[model samples]
Target: MKKFILIVVFSFILAGIFTFINQPQAETVNRPSDKETSNLFESLQNELYEIYDIGAFKTASNPNYTINEIIIPINGSQEYYDSVKDEVESLVKNIIKTTSFKNYSVIVEKNKLDQFFNEKAKDEMDLRYEITKTVHDSLYEAYQNQIGDIGITDSAQQLIIEVNTFFNGQESNDFFKEMENKLNIIFQEKLSSNLLVKESSITIHIYNKYGERIN
Candidate 1:
């Protein structure tokens, strides 16, 4: 009887050991450190700048390891930004998917610079668009469709006119200055009826057929 009891006890002990050994271990999650998260965000910022030529920054995360918001500074016109905003957001999403913190909710948006501008410059934007359209149509007609493209960059504080002409070697500082003067005349004529053109700074860039900024 003693021998049988000892064998039974030994069998129970062996079974218990086996059961403990076969039980699944709890999963270990490797959460990123605060420094690591900051580094990741910095890397993302650099990549965005390199790819899109836009300087974007991150706001403080809600939690240390989770990125929740990204701000894209609007350095161009509303029209220009609207044209590329979707593509830029898509690129950011794709990049985030490749990162370890993909599970975090990330929201990308234009900074308050644009929001404030849009709110305050609605009339200005309409007027500017009209002026640019008029200028573009006139130039296209005068150049016999030789005007390759006319792009505007409105940073809410200044206007930059980027003109590309198919006329090779025709782009010079003198030509650019002449174009600027013409633009100023039109702007003044249009803006004189309403606002004083609070943002009076206008920049003009002329490009040759080869897409080189000659002026």
Candidate 2:
């Protein structure tokens, strides 16, 4: 009975050792460090700069690091960007393949710098308009008596000032010119005084009492 018990105990110990050895181990995920990520960003940017005028580097990634998105802003016209978009995408894909994230689904997108800047300038001008509302209102009030209904609009990189005069008939070209010069000076002076106002060209449009554009 003692010999049989000893055999069974040895067999049980062997089974436990085999089970522990064969059990699958948890995967050790090597998440990228901050320094590593920065290096990768620099490397990708440098590669892109070699072929095109890059605006800025933009990237998005999830915690799992399975999906990565890179938005590359190219400084050129729409035609040029569209022509080279496929090439840019292929270049980016090839470069990414050499990295440890070879299996990651990399999505690349290209944007035109002109469109981006235009949109950004408009947004900035809108913000400035909101910030300098008091100044605008004061200027309008000061000029409303002289230049019958005055309307001001901020468009991209220009400040459009529309003046509807209370003149009985069509005004002379010289008259409109003089009015434009005067309003330009006043508007520039008042707007320039405010630091929030960006450097923008002023356009003056004059309309007669009959709603006909005089200038």
Candidate 3:
């Protein structure tokens, strides 16, 4: 029927207009409408974004690892810590044993980093002490400065810089506690799935409200 053909042509025209109108808008929005936060998981991530304001925004839907460096509290377990301790220590020792200053590294360290961490120079426990010190230094900086607060990117920028420094070890511990409260389910699932790095250690750096490091 001629009427049927006319109806089909009109429908096609409507679709064409929608496609045209959305094309330019699509290019400008680096993200998507789905990127908006609604689920509890995304809401949680958004909270971190609000507080620390570090990494890019990811909805609960995006499981892509490169966009996310660390997940909170889920990785903050003592049992999890124990399982990975030997693994991390062994990796550190092997790297130091095989590599030298000429290795051309990224994490800047002016001191004799290799010799300081050499297994020949220090025993297993001592290596732990050294590693903890390094983690503490980095974690302290992150906590205080919020230098790279995972998904956080707006508020607490100035305050976190100061807070991460002044918060004592006790406070660092408490922060981990809160973090665990928020992301424990994800942390547990990741650990069970063995989704984290083989050589990494997820540490809990506690601090006092005063910004001093706690135990």
TM-scores for all candidates: the values are 0.37, 0.41, 0.18
In terms of lDDT, the poorest run of 10 residues in model 3 is 152-161
Window of ten residues with lowest summed lDDT in model 2: 130-139
Candidate 2 local lDDT, 44-163, one digit each (tens): 778888778667766666676555566666666667777877787777778767665454445544555567787888886775665346434654565564445566676776767666
Each prediction's Cα lDDT score?
0.66, 0.66, 0.37
lDDT of 1: 0.66
Candidate 1 Cα outliers beyond 4 Å, as residue runs: 1-125, 170-173, 191-197
User: For candidate 2, what is the lDDT?
Assistant: 0.66
Model 1 Cα RMSD, Å? 15.3
Compared with the true structure, what per-residue lDDT tens digits does model 3 show for residues 20-55? Answer: 988763112122233332342354454433443222
Regions of candidate 3 where Cα sits further than 4 Å from its true position? 1-121, 145-165, 168-205, 209-215
Q: Indicate the residue-level lDDT of 176 in model 3.
A: 60
Best by TM-score: 2
